[model samples]
Target: MSHSSTIARRTTPGRLRHCRTRSERGAATAEYAVTIVAACGLGGILVTLLKSDVMLNALKHLINYALKLAGVEGLEL
Candidate 1:
């Protein structure tokens, strides 16, 4: 009901709003951590697959074909 009380109420809400905006930075950090873990998991799976003999043979054939097209003799992989 008083002038100072009214001013305090107005300023209190602004302070709370400012505090809310800072929390988004913490949320972004958490999201980045989760994303990195997921990406690492995906990369691990891909590396495992690529290291398999079948995937390596497939890639080797692809490279040999490309080299043949470029007039180089096919490579022994």
Candidate 2:
């Protein structure tokens, strides 16, 4: 019984080593990381596009306010 237990322990380490040496484990992690990065990049692009219109409108308002403070009237261009 003791001999069988020792053999089992030795075989377990060998199996673990073999699994770690396989390429599939690292490949899967690499693929997942690439996919996450691509998704984040795409999301950032979309958010920027969506925010730009709002930002432009706000800037226009601020410029108009500054012009009013400077005593500039409309249609003076």
lDDT of each: 0.87, 0.80
**Weakest lDDT window of 10 consecutive positions for candidate 2:** 16-25
Prediction 2 global C-alpha lDDT: 0.80
Query: Highest lDDT among the candidates is held by which one?
Result: 1
Q: Model 1 residue 37 lDDT?
A: 100
Residue 2 displacement in candidate 1 (angstroms): 18
Give TM per candidate.
Answer: 0.67, 0.41
TM-score of decoy 2: 0.41
Q: What are the per-residue Cα lDDT tens digits for candidate 2 across 10-73?
A: 7886687666555576887899999999999999998797589787687678888888889987
Model 2 spans with C-alpha error above 4 angstroms: 1-21, 54-77
